[model samples]
Target chain A: MINPINIGSIDDIDEGEAKVIPSDETGTGEDIAVFHAEDGNFYALNDNCTHETASLADGWIEGTEVECPIHAAKFCLKKGTALCMPATQDARTHKVEVSGNDLLLYPNVPAEPVEA
Target chain B: MSDCTSHTSEANASIGRMSRPEAFTQNIDVSTLVDSDGGLIDRSIYTETSIYAQEQRRIFARSWLFLAHTSQFKKPGDFFTTFMGEDPIIVTMDKTKTIRAYLNSCRHRGVRLCRADAGATKMFTCTYHGWSFDLAGALQSVPNEKAYPEDFDRKQWGLIEVPNVQSYKGLIFGNWDKDAQSLEENLGDMRYYMDAMLDRDPEGTEVMGGVMKWTLEGNWKLAAEQFATDWYHVNMSHASALMVLSPTGRGPKAEIAATPGRQFGSENGHGAGFPTHPKSRFDARPVHEYYDYEALRERLGDAAVEGPMTTGHATVFPNFSYLPVNGSIRVWHPKGPDKMEVWAWVLVDKSMPDEVKDAQRLYNLRTFGPSGIFEADDGENWSEIQAISHGFVTNNVPLNFQMGIGSERNDGTYPGQTSELYSDAAGRAFYRHWSKQMNTPAWHERTEQA
Candidate 1:
């Protein structure tokens, strides 16, 4: 089952920048970083850096990449690639949608197979 | 002539102004060790300073000390920094993929070359004078090539190589003494135990994650002796973890209460304190539930489950210690007379399931890391031993090692060696060997006789 989270209104942001808002309303344990690219597309990724377990929500978003403030391991906002040493794993990417004035996010759960 | 008088005289004499060499000489004295009843007190070997110094030279310097596993250097120009005794050295795999180790100091002014914990580099440029060396440890470039006359050859100014750098079963060891015994000869019977732990899997064992390096406030010998034969300390030292893990504290107690299988002291100083069966603290869980347990059992067959873990732990002479439970290898590298840096790596068969490897890593961290419960108890006692031993009066007195005296009888059970699977005399034997080398007049004499 996929639950849609209404983050913000479409007119609330401009192109080529991201508006990171608190995920407390969604009731999910994880906080998310919302990105609005220049191509009129929206993307969502887990706000935490996978390497040193740092919060990436406070990091700087430059072009398509978000640089983690702690160790500077960069992650692409569009495609989740942890492009640095230290962080060998990829960040969790979520599906984002915009309908009318509402910016929504579809949370994706990790697909680790349950042990018997 | 009387036993009481002889014992009193020996004890009194040992307390007097005995030089380091004299104390070391007394170690190999089998008669002085044997009690009136002939049982051996192995603890004496654990407490002596002369024997410890001798071990620094003979065992640590001469023998092949495990530096790192081969996988740490996977790519060309990949290098990792580690220490062999007090000397810092770097191990690198060149563009040709040949592994080599050299002193980490720059050839110019001895400044450290590789500052990062680990990374891939085309060349190591010194931070001081900008002197650089490449993967082959060759003097690659200098700022001014003709600064020195034609008499100065760049080839002669390469980083100093550790005399012996060799790997057996994927574990690499380095030695300072060029004339020392080969790695194979030094491993001796210990290789059998290593095979059971490492070679059981077809693809062999690979270090699952990064290593944990930490400092423990104890003499290196104290840590080494714990691995040698100190199973008796488990119930008391690790009572907290054992209480949590075991069905009851009485489970291992019930098994070992009657007659604990004796400690097997191997010819080349490898020691194993064998238990009768595979005793586990895991409550009613399937043996294979621990992940690598079943795969390892399947690989080594009866030996993996029934032999190594259940039977005993093997302390490979000087430094390496292996515990088969979830497969952990600990290498205790001595920093000095009283300080040691512990490097622990979790060993998993290459073919193990990912989930199992994850579990093993977690288990190893919880039990063995700096904050680990088991290591916490051990660190407390080890530090206290070092602290009290520094006292003036306490330092002069000898620590007691008079356990299992007169009970040791060398019966021909395991062939080709003097086998005594009866006592903690293994510790005593270690000290004896240690003292013998320390007291020997010259390194050449020790090498010649050895």
Candidate 2:
């Protein structure tokens, strides 16, 4: 069963900005990073980078991709796919949905089976 | 279990299975140097003279060793002198702009030729016996030609040439084994990491400053393996340096111990590590700040510049290693069983600004140069271990390397075999590959079958 927790209102995050939801709120040991992409959509991923112990919430966000500040590993905010070397594993994406003014987030899940 | 199967085996398994010449396979047994589990390596391999000789024959002679960077020989007649094992070699560019390497010894009396480290020369004339060889390593002139018989062939007396010479990206490598695989084949999956650090920008990279060399009393493998797989030592080995360099004055022990990172193991014994936090000006080090990411992104694309490129340390099996974050590259040249000659060079992007390059050089000097704090710390550790291994009781004991053994699982994330950030998986892999190379009879035995 998926427990959807309300993080904040949609106005809490600015366009193209990212916020780190603490682990306590996400019910996971690792924090969750919520991104308000320039694509006019919301996405969430595990805050810690797979390549290292960096917080993706502290990374640079442009368009729909986030670049880790520590090693520069880029992850797509829309799908949480690792787009290059160094970071070979894609970030685990969290289920997110916006309901009016409320932003609801679910635990991270395996990525959708990539298309052949 | 995520079926942590080794991808390297699928791509490059047959490299060790090829048949070799009977002459090369006559006698050599390195089965004693490595344990059956591939976890513990025999310490005597570091102090035994006989084992060192075997290493020269099987490892150095057969492997694609680093020779010179392509930027070192930009003009015709340019030459750089380096070593393949203990044998001195000179890499030169001939009139045709083809790069070649030759034994730096003259054919006559076996005198050392080309005493200079690097220079543009039309020909190399042996000081002991005036036997001159052109840039192509051909015997162009010989003093007192009248003394020789008319039938004597000067063509046959050219400098002994390295059998294979190849370049990947801008780094040139040479191998003495004629049947050795190409540099690309030897590199395998390691190329991905190399490209991430080296080929990120289209402008390419270049070597800066002359070589800084120093000798240390340590086994070459100690230094090589550490660079390849030892991130666990940083918190303790470099505690004092971090304390001095830390902005908060809180020291790096707790921060480093708590930080999360990944340790990567690859085919052919290559290993690398990445730090959890990125080093930059905001972290109180102006020298660590990279070039403007936006500008680099424009040229290198988002994936190349902004992906797992911040490598804190890495090794290309054997002695070649580097720290991508600081652009410091080194080769742990084996001097003997108990000693190694370290040759390090600073690398920087060709497009970085002068101030940034200067700052970067200063950073390298402060952190990894011969007298640098970290270098001094590592030197002491390696040397003390070598000294301790001289004792019979200690030498017989096996070092522990069982960290994250059965826990290794692949998430289809990185290439090659991998474990946790602070694990001995890479170390085990290094020993495994070392054992394989050492036990491979001889270079000729692994040549392509007729």
| Tens digits of per-residue lDDT for model 2, B156-246 | 6877788678777777778777667667877876776677667755677788878888999999989998888887887789888777877
Q: Over the stretch B374-448, how does candidate 1's per-residue lDDT look in tens digits?
A: 778988898888767666666655554446544444443322222233355555555555444444444433443
Q: How many clashes in each structure?
A: 5, 3
Q: Which CAPRI tier for candidate 2?
A: incorrect
Best by lDDT: 2
Per-candidate DockQ versus the true complex? 0.02, 0.01
TM-scores for all predictions: 0.66, 0.71
lDDT of 1 at B43: 41
DockQ for model 2 equals 0.01
Model 2: runs farther than 4 Å from truth? A1-116, B1-28, B36-38, B253-256, B278-290, B294-308, B445-450
